[model samples]
Target: MQVVIGKAITYEQQRLIKIVQKQLSEIDKQHLKELYEVTRIKHEPKDFSINEVKREIECGKDIQSLFQLANTILPQLKISNESIKYYASLVGYYSVYKLK
Candidate 1:
């Protein structure tokens, strides 16, 4: 995940970025690290990202559904309900940054 903080940031976008940074800071990083270490399969999954979904949500696009988004991102691993929900939650967290 490479992030480039460009010189063209708006005040509103910067504010939202701060909010996301704060929300991210409150999360238990170690737990997520452990979870990823345990649950990841050997296969290289699809290439979509939460940022992509956040871009869609920010654009006011009809995202249709989280399950659909999950399938788009994690293709082969949608064998269980929990996996989809988990990925959905992570993706949904970025919804806070959507333009309101």
Candidate 2:
């Protein structure tokens, strides 16, 4: 996306590029958040329950704490750092969303 944005040759093009970038960012965030929710529900972590994580997602307090918990548990499930980071950002973004 950055590469494409950089290719813009006009002022209007740049503005449109920014809008596209912002929209893509929001879409990425939504996908990540959904993935985070699904991952938590699909896997039972020793330190927490699926319902507990769901409740936390609802309240959105300590989203990073949930990220930390995901960081810890993902490795046990043999998930890669890329996946952990993906889910971590998903949880982290949920903090900004503030559904409660």
Candidate 3:
């Protein structure tokens, strides 16, 4: 997930990005930073929308905090119930995997 940072992000999107970055490991942050630079050079749309940010956070490895974040932000995003269920399942799968 490379964010292009093409345009000025809204305050909500910025907040979501900060939360995602906070949840990321140092290694993942470094990797994403490199990807961000490359995507910016390629002129790709790396700028994360609020929804995209929510999706990324939903799929993050840190299950507990990520799930909590999702619960907190999804409603704010006004995402559909189906999308919420999808993310919940993804979180459940990852959480189980981590327990193995």
Candidate 4:
């Protein structure tokens, strides 16, 4: 499904964006990278089961580590890239991270 991230962002939304981007960038797992790239290229949200996210984190990297990487990358998407919240919100919810 398509997510609308181009909606004007508020300051609180900016914080949320920063957190997710930071988390995404800190992730070190190959699978997480693969999943992220897939989502990016598709321009769609990823549909990963919690178990899958857990497995990718447990087997390759810690979930929080991946989240931290996300936090770093998310905000950059707005300025230097396309709005990834559409794709990222899927990852955030999949990873069970609360976005404010």
Which stretch of 10 consecutive residues in model 2 shows the poorest summed lDDT?
A: 36-45
Q: After superposition, how far is residue 7 of candidate 1 from its true place, in Å?
A: 38
Models 1 onward score TM values of 0.22, 0.24, 0.27, 0.28
lDDT of 3 by residue, 4-94 (tens): 4533346556776676666667755554434322222222234689866665555453334434544665666655799768854553345
Residue pairs in clash, model 3 = 3-46, 4-46, 4-47, 5-47
List ranges where model 1 is wrong by over 4 Å: 1-61, 65-78, 95-100
What's the ranking of the predictions by TM-score, best on top?
A: 4, 3, 2, 1
Model 3 residue runs over 4 Å out of place are 1-62, 87-100
lDDT of 2 by residue, 1-100 (tens): 8866666546545664465355444544554455445434334445578876676566454345455544544444554689657854664455434532
Model 4 Cα RMSD, 1 decimal: 11.9
Candidate with better TM-score, 1 vs 4 = 4
In order, what is each prediction's RMSD in angstroms? Answer: 17.2, 12.6, 16.6, 11.9
Residue pairs with colliding backbones in model 1 are none
Which 10-residue window in model 4 sums to the lowest lDDT?
36-45
lDDT of 3: 0.50
Cα lDDT over the full model 4: 0.49
Write one digit per residue (lDDT tens) for candidate 1, span 1-100. 1233453446545765555344433233333333322222222344569866665454333333322433443443323578557744653354332312
Better of 3 and 4 by TM-score: 4
User: What lDDT would candidate 2 get against the real structure?
Assistant: 0.51
Better of 2 and 3 by TM-score: 3
Ranking by lDDT: 2, 3, 4, 1
